[model samples]
Target: MSEYKFLTGLTSGFTPVIDAGFSLEDYRHIDLSVQNEILSQAQLDAPEAFQKYLDNFLLAQGGQIPWGGYNEHRGLYRRSGLFSAATEEDLIRNIHIGLDVWAPVGTGVLAVLDGRIHSFKDNNNFGDYGPTIILEHEFEAGKFYTLYGHLQRESLKDLQAGEKVKQGERIAALGDASENGNYAPHLHFQIIHDLQGKEGDYPGVANRKELEFYLSNCPDPNLLLKMN
Candidate 1:
């Protein structure tokens, strides 16, 4: 079966990755892409300033969680050398491949499905997913993975590879800017068809040149999230 068909089959309704206390009604789609005119380049490069913009956005929309980013062409990654292009010919990895759930620090992050821990790591790069976790799930046809990034430190301290986690289980908590690669507190949730032998991490962003392949490998998180 195709990736879209398989992913949509995995969940029957809105699957909560952030704290379950916040219902689907609390989720509001946010645009962080270049299309959003209000997002200045300077603010996108500053975590505190970017966070303030997010705060005002939520307040203005009367939203608790501003969730979006899958396949979005964003200007948010230009801040970090990890994703920035050094030369004019270099490919810029600014298209986000994962769905970002914006929330406060220490918010509970739950497993979207039953799976075993694949690996864990603390990616400390300035624009990286700090304290990452990848979980492996098996189906009749094959296996796939879900990655939880930008997590609190304690989430990894007690975790081990191959650990079993059930759906809705508290697997991690959102991390603040200090520990979570200097981004505002949020969960970068990605679903990967092929991990490409990586662990505790995977490309959460892609460039225009490689957009097609990346989008196929990392299907839209909304297939499972069903957040309207």
Candidate 2:
């Protein structure tokens, strides 16, 4: 099915990922580009450092979604060797495949649609999804999946594969540095048209070689969040 048709099916009563103090009016665009000023002045290697940057940005924007990350080529990942490739010939996966909703720790993460648990795992690494969950969804458009990464470890307790989760249901919570892949608190939301036989774990970044394929497979998540 077309991306527009799939997007239309995803827009519904999803729970807010941020605190009550925030709203659409408070949302601000973050620049992960090489020429970004705030990034130029800060170090993103440490989670606390990134948190400071997020705090300042939220204060400046009046506490809103620090939304931006789809296909963004960022230098922030340099802090972790996990993003490095053994051969220079292999394009480094710096382009983000998902839209990140930066918010505070413990923020409720709601399921965007009705689906069953597909898979989940604790991808513990320097730069990885600490606790991740993937849900399988089917609509008139087609069968697809929604992935939620950087979730609290406790969120995975008692969750079984194939368990049903209603739309707008609280499936997880935003995790902290100790649990969420050592990054700032945020929900990594991705749409996968095909898992390619994968389970709970999926590549959240793409390199130049496979950019075209991934870009088409994982459409912009803002199509569902609608938080432009």
User: How well does model 2 score by local distance difference test?
Assistant: 0.81
- lDDT (tens digit, per residue) of candidate 2 on 86-175: 356347777788988888889888888789999999998979989999999988877989999999999999999999998778899999
Clashes of 2: 0
Q: After superposition, how far is residue 104 of candidate 1 from its true place, in Å?
A: 0.2
Query: Candidate 1's residue-wise lDDT over 1-228, tens digit each?
Result: 274687787899999998999988888899999999989999888888988998999889987999999989898988888887646433888899999999999999999999999999999888899999999999885899999999998899988898999999999999999999999899999999999999888999887788899998998888888999
lDDT of each: 0.90, 0.81
Q: Give the lDDT of residue 156 in candidate 2.
A: 94
- Model 1 misplaced stretches (Cα beyond 4 Å): none
